[model samples]
Target: MRPGYGHTLRYLGAARGAITRRQPIFPTCYGDALQGSPVADITADPQSGWTGVHPAILAMNCLAYDAATLGNHEFNFGLPWLTRMLSAARHPVTCANLKLTCGRFLPPYLLLDRMIRSHDGEKHPIRIGIIGLVPPQVTSWDHLHLGDRLISEDMVKASRELVPRIREEGADLIVALAHTGIDTGPAHPFMENAALQIAAVPGVDALLAGHSHQIFPDSTVPGTDGGAVDSAIGTLSGTPAVMAGFGGSHLGILDLALRRHHGHWTITGHRSEARPVTSMKTGIAAAPDAEISRALTKTHAATLRLTRRPIGHSPAPLHSYLAMVGDSAALRLVNAAQHEAMAELLRGTAHENLPILSATAPFKAGGRGGPGHYTDIPAGPLKLRHAADLYIFPNTLCGLQITGALLRDWLERAASCFNRIGPDARGVPLLNPEMPSHDFDVISGLTYRIDLSQPARHAPGGALASPGATRIRDLRHAGKPVRASDVFILATNSYRAYGGGGYPDLPDTERIHTGKTQVRDVLVRHIRSRSQVAPPAGVTWSFASQPGASAILETGPGVRRHAAELAALGATDLGGGSGGFVRLHLPFDGPLASRGNDN
Candidate 1:
């Protein structure tokens, strides 16, 4: 999130912009979890964990951010760690929907008293109230850390309740920092994306939307094409709302025409836009801020040192370019690490007799982060930092004992990541837009097939889509069909076992063991325990064959280099795709496990 503070100062029609400027820029941030996503606040420095703040916070303070809010990723680390990080922010961090278990809540809104210059060279006083909101699904996504301690309320509901109070506090304007995306559909309780509904709230004058990382008012983006979002004018449901792109790629600017009607401050008309900060052809537009660079010198060096530490070796390349459609060497190595760690924890336990099924996911599947987001580690010596590329999140390990029926339901929920396809549907999208790539989990120790022609049993948010519907075909273990009454112990990360993805909820009794060790550490330990680690032999799941059907899978453009890999799976390269992605025509003609990690 390296943005040029000086460029923003020049674009806003100010002769001088600094600590003494009276025009008031009102520089507010939509929200991102942590700095750089370079392991989200983890560094080689000793004082940079739970007790110390990340360099990103220091950069924000140096750049002078007025206010900010929480994103779902903010809850990835436990509460103690998050509380320590927020204490370092120079600006107020507000979120109306977040409630703590101690019968208290974080700052819901901020009342800022500012002065703006009039047309006749006079200064006018304005009181602006900014209320913050995060997605209610934060609890589910970080269920391990947020287990009953923290609860997230619905976005629209919180706005309805808090906006009136802000107005009662004698504020002229109210802006909502809604960390969500624009949705034209009907508003429901506990919905993850709800900017369109929050915009319709009576007292809210304007809103800054985020969370999906899709830029509003941009016709080329996927989520902004809805009817409620007038992409031409940057308005959501007639409210002046703006959603900038992620990682500081774009800046959301909202210009309001202030008018005094009968002595009350009113907004007549406004201009809104999401401005790109850097161009792909020309690189960064302005000089790098020296203050920001100096503040991050120590952390940047520490991070580089952390990423370069060596671990072990690999015989074949590990990449996630084909994770969405086929087997992944990246995930295969993670599953092995998770299963090995859980075995040592359950060696003397009473549940040791039960079989352990390791569940892992493909984190770098080229979703919103663009085509270059996938992990592509070359064969040879491995480094400690490669563990970060393979296992992105800072999640801990946990083991859960559940019946076979619940396991099937878990896989069914993961199956909701794809859309329903018919036998005759050709060249349709292979993925569901509402589902994030992290929710697509591939569990090991079981062989199953997902039927794309059938409707998904659950929706993207874990709601029941079809009753008695089955998308998992022929679930089996050890070459035998699994029964509903059979029992198994699943070793997974705290996010999934406690409730990270929209999987089913299990009680405390169901959890056999929850380790305090991070999954990345377990991966490091597993790799070091062997002379040279190799990718798993076979895949755990495959697509159920559908005749004369095909789908398009968007991935990194680098997939073209693996020509023999694509030929083995009978996939066709559709060339460059929209939004800087490459398209692969998936015909489902052969088993995905037919090929290994070879070029």
Candidate 2:
């Protein structure tokens, strides 16, 4: 349901056209695209060509959404901007979980009385109740704006408290518009994925879930309990559900057959599915609706001009195709910029003398976004779009005071990106498909080696998996071994510093500095400060020497162009793997260890 900046107006127009043909469209959007910062400042002066959230609001208004919900990214521009956007919408915005401790501009739920055409061509009046839910982590994710002004209760708990009340208010059918994922893992108080739990609630007849940015009814999804999820028949706790992929890639549809019995309407049968705007195998590619495109033409042109504006120049090409293998120019540029910004921000503070370690992850490493998602900018003029591509999210820069022990634990958690490799299992796949690229953080101010032979100390969800296992080795800061008690101010995004990824030992008390500036802005400023930027060349960490051990890494297909550079790293081309990834074989030897030791 999240229509971010990635999709063009043309794409959205095409998606909307498909939705109208099915039924009375109840359009829903899960926020985060009014202003993506350095990428496209939609909030740039009102007199300017950029129309801020006007175009987005107009587009949704044209579709005539029955009701909508706010995603976590809705607060990217602060509560005031969001309040104005909501006010501009023709339809009401419902969010049951978000409590305004100070003031309220949105409703908790909306009841719509609609006349639906039954199977026999008879019109039946039904009261449809819609409730919206956003993740409770929004407070921590956008602490600068929300702080103590907003309070988000648990999704499941909120649904239980509000659903019955909505039902009592003459709601024939209840539809939960949850901005959460459908993770079937163990339930936690503030779990990011609470769709399954919410679906189990008695009054919830149907649900539309989002926020994981992944497709549902996807038969390929494996459950955490070693079971396969029948995503094709999207259901949670026997309740029909749908989760449309992000950026208007797909439109989720849930068709329910209702029956009137005992003076009450109930869902008798339901079918849930997601339709893609463009499908290669089915050979269906629809054109954008002329009306929608015409409406957004001005905003689209303005965004293009702003994104393509030259910011600076890079001496060498920046690409994330090989980021997982070693240090890439794109990641190095982000780390350097974040480090510089944090260093300056902490000046004159108590944390000024503390060593600043910038932690960043490769945003476009080709996993869920597919092969073409990799950031590959040719060496030449660097535009604002390039910097945006380097650091994708709108997360603000923050500094956290963490001990050496916590840092090592964080690295160990990052090391979970790789699958455990046995010494005898040669030619096995190295990267774990479950570990997201964003979770594989790499700190810039330290040197370490990851021992692939050892098991991951933490699981993908950040729980301790192997108690004594140690993947991070040779941990040193400034050529000296860092003790467990050594404290350092880590430069990271608000998400990580606020324990977004369930990182061990980081709490609000540890936060030392929080900057209002977005991280992408810092990257742009860092680039503009210099005429020609060249990132440092070398690998910070590498797999431990396994002698005869060999593993295959899957990356974007574009890696073939850098064959010579990859050969130097002892990686042999093994041709293409499944999806759009090219396989590269790495053979571990003593000489490779020496190359990995370079700072």
Candidate 3:
């Protein structure tokens, strides 16, 4: 389905119209069918009717798309369910790298024999080969579900091997549907951004890329070589490419002009671009397609009903506008839920005696998702939608055994979210824009302060930058300093525990428990189990005092209402920042009056 919101029906219609009158529109997707809904459970299976991507599949079938590819998120519900869903599509689902350990077969690529109209209005028969490749990181991201059931190959390697085979199968041209991002970094066996390398593969004519949720044909992206990307004229190693922005935001279009020479078809020229569904200047979106609206009426109604059902209550509001600045109630609640669930699961196990810690980050903090992305829930009945807002991904819960030193290192890596501040650099920006909000993790059950003056031990992407530098100070458990050898059980999602975000000190062998339950489901259950849930009041961590030194931070516009609360944490309202974010000035020497109490 349309992931978040936009007029997908109208977007698709516009995309269809962009092509030549007699040419067929090729629609492709890069996985992740659930969790993008403004309403939750649109991907959930209700007792009475079909759910998840069923409606989206129906819409695609109605549109008569030629073929599609798999994305990493497609396996969120597990392999069996994903297989069933893919099989239900009228169009072929092709992936060259995915392999099933259970002996289940999925074609490595798809070959389409179709007729195309040239500039002379003459139709020519052509065999077009489409190959799909997803990042191999899926094996780690979905380890619990796909551990023994399936495996994935490196995108570059898979493409190199499959492109020639597809060419030999009498195909005139080849198109790669790579669920990867474009980067000019040195090639690695399992690098996430392999689009450039994939493009260099022989016989590949055009490429459709995704998974970075970024738009090509835009000049915003910084290439790996430290240069601005001319996204508007997107290309990877001279091959025309387009990455449609996520969630129907844009449609990637690539036009190839072909010619027949010596009984062989070859691409002579090409053009590529991405079209947005919403107007950039006026902030207006296209109208929804009446036909698609009519087609999805029942499913949409059911999704709304299911998401609005009251599930629990919160004694205090849960918001994350100022999450990166101080202790966030929203993240605190999530940590509590993970801790509670993990504790219960280990009650009778040998590991029950170990202290339980939870690792959580503010997923809604404004970044790539834009300023309006913060989570703000009023104190009252909580709906499933609220829970989904609290924890966005469908990531499964996992418990890891780690030493105190390792935990400290983990926190140090997370502390890289902030920029190193100079003693006299008051009002200097404090955040590292390159660091994603998801990677700025805060650990519950431990008290520590991040000294922003010190160089961070790790870079934003989680690589070790300064091994000897220590930004985390006063790391303690139960009011006592944690020793390097002290062991603890950490409740985190499979992604972090399995080293998905480049977090250090965690090896998969250290995993003590992997729950089948999704973290969002755990949050819902935890909220329902309590009559009134509230985060412990006080700061878990705070900036080290630097008299007269101030730093600026950006948050959502709605944070103005909580100005006094922010002041208590040493932040003064300074109005707006760039990109719809509100700016706040925090004095390092100010008293931490709003610090939460440690339990």
Best by TM-score: 2
Ten-residue stretch with the least lDDT total in model 2: 7-16
Reference-based lDDT, each prediction: 0.76, 0.75, 0.75
Clash tally, candidates in order:
1, 1, 12
lDDT of 3 by residue, 291-368 (tens): 878878887887777778888888778899888878889999999999999999999999999999999999878775
Give the root-mean-square deviation of each candidate in angstroms.
4.4, 4.5, 4.1
What local lDDT score does residue 323 receive in model 2, on the 0 to 100 scale? Answer: 80
Identify the leading candidate in terms of lDDT: 1
Deviating ranges (above 4 Å) for candidate 3: 1-24, 38-53, 102-105, 222-229, 257-270, 426-429, 504-509, 546-551, 569-578, 587-599
Summarize candidate 2's per-residue lDDT along 1-599 as a digit string, tens digits. Answer: 23542211000111111211224425555445454444235653343455455676777777666677778878766787677767777878888888888765468899987765544445557788888888888888788877788987899998999999999999988888888877666788877778889988999988888877667766667433422244646687778887776766677777765567666776655667776666746635568768768877777777677788899998788888888766677888888898999889888988899999889999778776666668888889999778878887778899899999989999998998888777666887888766678888988888888888888887767778897999988888988888999999888998787777667535668888887787988998999999988665656676677777878888888888776668777888888776547888887664444565653
- Which of the two candidates, 1 or 2, achieves a greater TM-score against the reference? 2
Where in model 2 is the C-alpha error above 4 Å?
A: 1-22, 31-41, 44-53, 103-105, 222-229, 282-285, 504-509, 589-594
Clashing pairs in 1: 495-500
